[model samples]
Target: MKEELIVKAYEVAKERYAAIGMDTDKAMDALQKVQLSLHCWQADDVTGFESAGELTGGIQATGNYPGKARNIEELRQDVLKAASYIPGNHRLNLHEIYGDFGGQFVDRDQVEPKHFESWMQWAAEHNMKLDFNSTSFSHPKSGSLSLSNPDKSIRDFWIEHTKRCRAIAEEMGKRQGDPCIMNLWIHDGSKDITVNRMKYREILKNSLDEIFATEYKNMKDCVESKVFGIGLESYTVGSSDFYTAYGASHNKIVTLDTGHFHPTESVADKLSSLLLFIPEVMLHVSRPVRWDSDHVTIMNDDTLDLCKEIVRCDALDRVHIGLDYFDASINRIGAYVIGSRATQKCMLQALLEPLDTLRKYEANDQGFERLALLEEAKSLPWNAVWDMFCLKNNVPVGEEFIAEVEKYEAEVTSKRN
Candidate 1:
C-alpha cells in the first residue's frame, strides 16, 4: 500500500473514531505494545531438534507442508522472517525439545541451561526474550501418565525434567532481565475408565508440591490444564478446576490455552474471575476446530472477546499474551504472520471501543441502546487503523504480505531438501 493512501485512510478513521469519543492514536499505540510470544513449534511442526521424533500425548500438527525447518539455524531464520512482517517487539516461546543438542542425544531428565546457551546468545543478538515449556509429551517414558503416574521412577523422571526446565527459564530471564513465563502442562491422563481416579489426583498433587518446592526470582511458574487429549478421552488429571485452585492457593500464574476447553465454554468469561484471584495469567491463543485441534488463529469472536476483556478489566500489563498454534498445512512463515496479525487486529478493534459511552448507556439501564451501539461498533473503520499500524511499523500493509510470503516460499523455503 502507498504511504499517502495509508495516512489518508487513517486520518479519516481518526475523525470517525473521534466523533464517538475514541482515540485511534491511543488504540494504535496500545496495539503496538502487545508483544505476542510467538510459538517456536510452528516453524518446525513441533519437530524439535531433539532428533527425529513423532508427536504423541494426544496432540498432533497434521500436514505435509514442505520446507519445514530442519535444525536450529533454519528455525531461527524462519522466525526472523515471520517477525519481519509482524509489528512490535515480541518474545519467543520454546519447548525444551528445541535445544542446541549438536547431534548428540540428551535425555529430557538431563537437559540444562548449557543446552540453550546458543539460543540465549542468538536471542540477545536479535533483540528478543524467551519463554519456556517442559516437554512431557513425545517421549518414550511419556506413556499415558507422567506426574500422576503410579510408577515412582517414571514420575520422578518427568519431575526432574520439569525442574531443569525452570532453571533454564530462569537463566533466560536473568540474561534478558525479564521474567520468563515457564509454563508446565503435562499430558498425564487416562485413555479409558480408571477406578484409581482419586489415587492419581492425589499423586499428581504430591508431585506438584515436590516440583514447585524451590523458588526462582526471574521466572514465573504457570500450570496449564486441558479437558482431555485425543486418546485420553476419559479422564484428565489436571483439569481447569485443579489448575485454578492450585494457582490461587500457590500464588502461581495460570495458563489458559484456547483449545483446551469444551466448545461451549468461553475463555474470555474466565478472565474477570481470574483477575480477582491469580497474580497473573498467561494466554495460549489458538483456534480449535471442534476439539483441541491447534488451528491457526484468526480475528474471530473468541479472540476479540479475549482481547476486549483484557482491556475492559484494565489487566493489560497483568495478562501475558502468547500465540499457541502450529499449522503445518500451509507456509509456516505465513502461518506465523497471519496468526500474529489477526490477533493484533482483534486487539486493535477492542481498544477502539468507546467503553465510557457504552458503560453510561448501561448505567442508565438503557439495554437496547447498549446492544445497538455494540452491533454498530462492528462496522467501524478499525481496519484503517490497523493499516496505519502496519505503516508505522514499516511492515507490509494489508494483503501485500501475501505476495511477500509467496516470494519467500519461492526463493527460500521451497528449496529446502
Candidate 2:
C-alpha cells in the first residue's frame, strides 16, 4: 500500500515538473530521492515542523498530504496515527514532530512557556522520546562566553536552561507518567585554541557538572562523541568519558549513535568496551549518507549485521534504540516506514546469524531449549519477540536483559584473563 502511494506520488510529481517545462532529469532525481527515502528501512517518517500557518504553506508547496489537514488538531491526529503505524521498538527522532509544539531553538526570552508545556504533553501522550547529539541545547550566551574567562551570567544561563528542562519534565510527569527524557549535547569547547585546551576541558566539565547536578540529576545522560572535525573536536565525552561520568554521577550512561565514531573504529569492540563501563546505553540508529550523523537513509546490511551481533551479545536490553533523523523534506509516514524496516531488518539479521544460538545459550544461563515457544523464539516475528521480551522481562525495549549480558561479558573476560 505504501509503495503504491509512493509510486503514485512520484508519477504525479514527474507530470507536474514536465508541465512546468522543468528539467525532467532533475524532477526524476528528486522523485527517486523521495522514493529512496520512503523505502529506506532506518528512516524515521516524520512531518510537521511548521505552525498551522507554515503547515498551510507547506501543503501548498508540496501539494501533498498536509493539504488534507485543515487545522492544528487535524495535523496532530495525523501525526499520532503516523506514530501508531510505526513499529513499537523503532527509535523516533522528535525534532520535526515537536518543532510546532514549542521546542524550537529560539532565544530563551522568546520561548513561550505554555507552548513548551503543550509540546511535553504531546510527546508523553505519543510515547515518543527525544535524543540530541550536540545541537540539542541553545543559549544566548554561546557567542559571549569564553572558556578562558567564563562569565557568571553564562553559568547562570546554563543553570536556568537546566531548571526549565526539569520543569518541563515535571510537567510531562504530571500529564503523562514519566519525566522528560532528554539527550544533552554541549558544544562548550573552542576550535581555534591549542595552548589553553586543558582549561577549556576543565571549564566544559565544570559547566556540565553544574548542569547535570541541578537539572538532570534524575534524567539519563547519553554522552555522544562528535568526530566531524580533525580530532579532539570537543570535550572527552564519548563512551570513555561516559565511564568517568557514570562512575561519578548517578542516572547517567552513554547513548551511542553508530555513525559518530571514525569509520575505522570497530563498532562491536566499542559496544563491548562500553558495556564494561556503563550498564546501559541508548542508541540512535541511522545510516550515514555522506559521512553525516543523522541521515534518514536506509540501513545497509553491514549495519544490520552489527546490530545482530549486539543482540546476540544481549546488549539490546541495555540500549534504548531510536530512529534519529533531522531531515525536514520527508513526510512522517515515510519516516515511520524507514524506522520500522530498519528495526525489522536488524532483528531478522540477529535471528538468522549463526552466533545467535551460542548467544542464546549464554543468555539463558543454561543449555538450548526444547519447548515450542523457545524454538519459535528464534523465528517469531521481530516485533512479536521484542514485545514478549518487554513483557517477560518487565523492562522496556532496549533495556531488557542488559544486566545478564554485562555479567556474562565480565565472566568471559575474567576467564580469558
How many clashes (backbone N, Cα, C below 3 Å) per candidate? 0, 13
lDDT at position 306, candidate 2: 62
Q: What is the TM-score of each predicted model, taking all chains together? A: 0.99, 0.58
lDDT of 2 by residue, 1-417 (tens): 533444455455445434433333432222122111111112222233333322210011222322233334544554454443333322223332233443344544233335445555555666554332222222235442322225766656555554454444444445544333455544344335456545645665665666566543334455554443323243332234533464336546666566666666655556676667676766655555545555553657546656665665666556556555544354434444455445545654354333534446567865544243345534433433333323332332332234433453344322322
Relative to the true structure, candidate 2 reaches a TM of 0.58
Each prediction's Cα RMSD? 1.0, 17.5
lDDT of each: 0.93, 0.44
Candidate 1 lDDT by residue in tens digits, 253-356: 99999989999899999999998999999999999998655899999999999999999998999999989999988999999999999999989999999999
Candidate 1, lDDT over the whole model: 0.93
RMSD over all Cα atoms, model 2: 17.5
Candidate 1 local Cα displacement, residue 278, angstroms: 0.3
